[model samples]
Target: MKCITRSLSCLILATVASVAVACSGADGADGAMGLPGADGEAGVKGDPGAAGENGDKGDPGTAAATEGTLTGTVTDAVLKDPLADVTVTVKDSGGATLGTPVKTGADGKFSVKAPVGTVVLKLTKTYYTDSADIMVGVIAGTTVSIAATMSEAATGAPTVTLAWTGDDFGYGKTATLTATASSPTGSTLTYAWANNTATKIGSVAAGTDPKTATATLPTLADATKLRTEGGVETQYVSAYKLPDRLEVLSIVPDTRGAVSVGVTVTDGRGQKATASASLNAASIQTGLRNVALGQRVYLNSGHDGTNAWTLTTKPAGSTATGRGGICSPPPRGGEYVRGGRESRRDSRGRSSAT
Candidate 1:
C-alpha cells in the first residue's frame, strides 16, 4: 500500500510541473492597435496686452497759397464818371478766358481771384465802346489795383465819309476832296482841311461849299526838298525872324510816296468828326531838282526867251534875285552882262537890262 501512494504522488507532481512550464512560455506577438479617442473642449481666453509707447513727433508742415487777388475800377473816359454794370472778362496771354466774367458795382469797383501770371481784361457795356485786351499782372498772395476807362458811344455824334473825285490823280494833278458829313440833328457842318505828309507838297484849301475841299497836288516845280534829322518833320524855321512865328519846311521828294487829306467836320454843337483819304503822288518828270532854300540846283539850258523864272535861296546865300534873260553869276562873283545890253543896278538893289 505504501508503494502505491508514492507512485500517485510523483504523477501529480509531474502534471503540476508541466502546467507551470506552459504558463512561463516566451511573449507572443502584440495584438492589433485600438481606435483613437475624441479631442477635449477648449478653455476660456485671457485678456489682451497693453498698447506700446508712441513714436517721436514729426516735422511741421508748409503753407500753401498759389493764388492772388485783382481789384479795379471802370470809368467813362469822356465824362470821367464811374461806370456800373460793366462786364469784365479776364483772359490769359494766349487768349484763353480765365474764370467767370465779373460785373462792376455802382461805384465801378470789382474784385476777382487769378493765378500768378499776366492777364488781360476785356471790358464791355451797352452805350459804351468795348475796351478789350487790357493787360494786368498778378502776384501770389497779393492784391493789385488798377483803373480803366472807356469812351462814350457815337450814337448821336456826327459821322463823316470822305472820297476823291478821280483815281487818276497823281503828282501834278488837282484832287477834289469831298466830305459828306451829317449830324443826327442835321446841323450845318463846317469842314477844316489838313495835309498829312512830312512835306507839304501842295496847298490845301477849303471850298466855298461847306463839304468840299481842294488839295492841289504838287508839280515838279512846286515840290521842294529839304534835309531832315531822321526823315521826320518836326523842325520849323521862322518866316519873319520872329519868335513863335515859325513855318514848316518842305521835304517833297521826286519819287513814289503817299499824301493824305484829312478833313474835320464840325457840327453846330461843336462836336467834330474826322475823315481822311490817301492819295498817291509821284512825279513823272525825272532829273528835276529842287531850287528852294538850302538846295543846289541849276536852270535848264533850253529855256526860251519868253520863259520867266524866279530863283529863291540861290546856291550862294538865302536871298534870291530875279533876272530877265539868263541866270547871271552870283553877287559874290561879278554879274554876267548878257545879250550885249548894258547891266545896271536898280534902286531895289536888283540887276536889270538896259
Candidate 2:
C-alpha cells in the first residue's frame, strides 16, 4: 500500500511541475513583459460595492457641435405679398459670405444653417432693391425667425407722345404744342421742348399745362428781304428771351421749305422721350397787323426826280390785312409802312414799321 501511495504522489508532482513551467520562470528574477493576449471572456458580474466619497471634479469635456438656424419670409414692400425666387444670404460681421446663398422656395420662406454668432440676413431679387441689412443673434441650438420686405427698383423708362395744332407758321401766327407721357407706374411727367440740333434754335419752355406750349411765328429780320430771298431765314430768338417779345422769324434751310418739328418730353423721374414731325408754316401776310384798319401801304420815297421804283401796295393790297402784291407808289401821301420791312421812312424818326 505504501508503494502504491509513493507512485501516486510522484505522478501528482510531475503534473504540478508542468503547470509551473507554463506559468512562470524558475530563476525567480522577473522576465521582460510579454505582449498581452486578447482578454478572456468577461468574468461573471460582481455584486455592487459600497459607495465611496466623491474624489475630485474633473476638467469639463469638449462641447458638442454648436450650430444655428435661420428661418425667414420675404415679402414685397409695396404690395405686401410674399415674394418667391429671392436669394437669402447670411454674412459674418466682416461681411464675408458664410455659406452658399439660400434661395427662397415657392412659399417665399427659407431656412439655412450657420455657425453660432452675430450674423446679417439679406434678401435680394432681380429688379428689386435689397432689404435693409438685418442683424441677428444666432444663439447656439436655436432657430431665429426673420421677416424681410424688398422694394421694386425704379425701373420705369418713361415714354411720351407729342402733338401740336396749326401746321402753318407765318410771322404773327401761333400754334399749340401738347405732350402726353406714359409710364409703368403712372408717375407724374414733365414737358420740355428742344430743337432738333439741340443748339442754335435752343429750347423752349412749355406753358403751365406741363403739356401745352404756344409758339408764335415771328417776322423776318429784314422787311425788305421778304421781297428778295424768300427763304434762308436762319436765326431764331434766344430761348431765354420771352416768346411774346419775339417778332423776327428766320427762314433757315430747316424752315426755308416744309419741315419737321421736333420736341422732347421728360418725366418727373428724369426719364426722357423725344419725337419728330413734318410741319409746314402758315402763309405769311405781307402787311403787318400793326397797321390801322384802313391804312394805305408803302407809298413815298426820297424821289430824286424818280426813275427809282419803290415797293407800293396794290389798291386792294393797300390795307394792312391785304394780300402781298406790288403796284405803283400810292397816289397820295398818308401811306404807311409795316410788316418785317421798312417802307419809305418819310418822317425819319417818327416813321414806324412792324
Each prediction's RMSD over C-alphas, in Å, is 22.7, 19.3
lDDT tens readout by residue for model 2, 141-195: 8899988887666665567777876554543445676767676645466666654
Error of 2 at 217 (Å): 14
Give per-residue lDDT, candidate 2, residue 96.
90
Name the lDDT of candidate 1. 0.61
Q: What TM-score would you give candidate 1 relative to the actual structure?
A: 0.30
Q: How do the residues 167-219 of candidate 1 rate in per-residue lDDT, one tens digit apiece?
A: 42544667787888887745577788898655666667888986888877664
lDDT of each: 0.61, 0.55
Error of 1 at 201 (Å): 1.7
Q: How many backbone clashes does candidate 1 have?
A: 0
Candidate 2's clash total is 13
Per lDDT, the best of the predicted structures is 1
